[model samples]
Target: MTLALVTDDMTTGVLKTTDGERKSRTKLYWKRRREALSAVALERLADLGIEFPVVAGTMTIPEVCDYFSISRSTLTNIARQYYEELIEAGYMPGSVTQPTRYSELALAHVAMILRPSTSDQAMIIQKALGIYRAPRGAVKVHNQSGAHVKVCGRVLDEAYKLVSEIREDDPEEVWKALEKRNRHELQVLTVALAALVPNDRGGLRAWLAEIGLGIHSDAQNKAAVGLASLVPSRQQVSE
Candidate 1:
């Protein structure tokens, strides 16, 4: 009696004899190659901070094969063996429905490892708080219209609250926020704010300078300076 094993290769399915004869040699060869590929993928996933079963959750068998340029059989075998280890180790959630959804814990771990530094955090806080102030005379114009613009009450309140809580508790949170800002916005804001406030500790002064400079220069250094000096200074007064 001949025993047959049925297998699929996505595009096609085939049957092979279980006995070590004829087509069995080719099947075994393919199997070995598949297993090697799976091992490579498993090692890469571990290095990338993907929690075992959870990382498996983030990709389908085919996706793993495609991402690592491996065969489906190897991917399936690796996932089946190590996925349980991942779950047992609490790297993956207890109940996972799909292979494409990793646990939040895994994502958090990756983010913590990838988070930025403190000075970057401070620059971000400064830029966010600094961009809401009014021009020296613009407030009078605004007051004439009965429109009182509250910088803290409006723009910076939420950001400030978040930053204060984080500065003492999780300094990394501050760096994350700063890293999210556009580089151009950050550079322009930094340069303009530096020129205006000169003193870094005062929030109100920093905000006003940032806004005044931002509007005058559209955060452009050349435009900011030109707009800043648009009004003739006392030094430029002629007798």
Candidate 2:
């Protein structure tokens, strides 16, 4: 009687493990189709918010098998089931394959949800993956030959300092406080402009003369009308 009971226990154990064994083989069946997954399909996975490389589309079988941890011949047999669809999706690229992407219908048919690619998708993915870069310095300088333009940063700080000595926003008020002979705002603007380019006095004089600034052009800082060498090219970048 004891021998009979041991035989029954062995039979029960095999029955219980059979389901898990079949499931393992099923997973392996799908995993071996290496050529099935394509770059575009991977992008599609990102779009779909699918976890990892796993996807259900005709072209996504390799990914699905991978997710299931299936390998070897079992993966090959499962892959054969979607073999035709994979070829149609251009996964099996050959001589005549003109490099095509998977179709929407095919992608949707398989279980992968296809999401639209947005302009911010790249940033979103980076954020999702916890990737970031440190911010850069804010100071910017633009050179247009001798017309050196220091944008924002130090320029704004200096402008505000000069302006605070007189009025906040009104150039006329600033001039009045300084007691200039000519109340013209342009004259004041030119003087204020001079402060920006302490390094390029010649360029300042040339620019001032053209606008009838009437400020004596320093013989020591002469600049040609056709030449403004201190100014930076628009294409050049400085931080």
Candidate 3:
């Protein structure tokens, strides 16, 4: 009687294991069906050539993958295969190291891929171009109490325009023209013009001249004297 019971228990366990396998197979089938649908959607998007977008004024490979929820390997393969197809026909810039570093050629490539409107393309190009730098400096004045005061800030945009105009002409010519102006007049003009020009030693000199101040001639002379003094002292050492 005990042996008969043991055999019955073994048969029941085997039946349960068979049922579990059937359920697992059904789940796998549904999972595969969903993956197939997702793959179809991705392919449809690829057919429409909707992979790339402008990022930081450049077209990047990773940005496209992230936007589409696609694997890197799959995207890379797709890019390699359809790269010329997209370029020759679709007008996309393909991919680069970073979107921010997109060159003019790259922008042209993107234009083909995206088929942007002429105006839209122009805007994108504008955004990608380098921005102009603004000028900045410190202002100093002596108060009635004989205290020296200084204020530092960016020059006004209008002042920058004047500086830009001045740069278009010769620097020495601009200085010689301003030489006859009084200190107060020079100060106002120099500060206004400096705001527009690129920062450099020449620009600094131009700025000083605009303000009725010349380059530190006394400092240069003093340095020359000091060097001459050192030469005699050095000769004494050698003797």
List of clashing residue pairs for candidate 1: 57-99, 57-100, 217-224
Give the per-residue Cα lDDT of candidate 3 at 189. 57
Query: Which run of 10 residues does model 1 get worst, by summed lDDT?
Result: 109-118
For residue 43, model 1's alpha carbon misses the true position, in angstroms, by 15
> How much RMSD separates candidate 1 from the native structure?
27.6
1-239, model 2: which lDDT tens digit per residue?
01112245446522234555676774554333322443354465466584343133333444433433333233344235665655554443324544223343333222221111211233343333333222255222223444344433444565567646433345445444445444544454545666456542345455434533333444433344222232333454242
Q: Count the backbone clashes (under 3 Å) in each candidate.
A: 3, 17, 13
Model 2, residue 205: displacement in angstroms? Answer: 80
On the 0 to 100 scale, the lDDT of residue 182 in model 1 is 84
For each candidate, what TM-score against the reference? Answer: 0.17, 0.18, 0.18
Flag the better candidate by lDDT, 1 or 2: 1
C-alpha RMSD values across all candidates? 27.6, 29.0, 28.9
User: Where is model 3 more than 4 Å wrong at Cα?
Assistant: 1-53, 56-58, 89-239
lDDT of 3 by residue, 77-184 (tens): 444544653343332443354232332233333332231222243234323321111224523231334222122223244355545655466555655555667896
By TM-score, how accurate is candidate 1?
0.17
* lDDT score of residue 52 within candidate 2: 40
**What Cα-based lDDT does every candidate model obtain?**
0.40, 0.39, 0.41
lDDT tens digits, residue span 106-208, model 1:
2222222111231232223223322212224431211313233453233344444543554354444554565687875455445444434323254533433
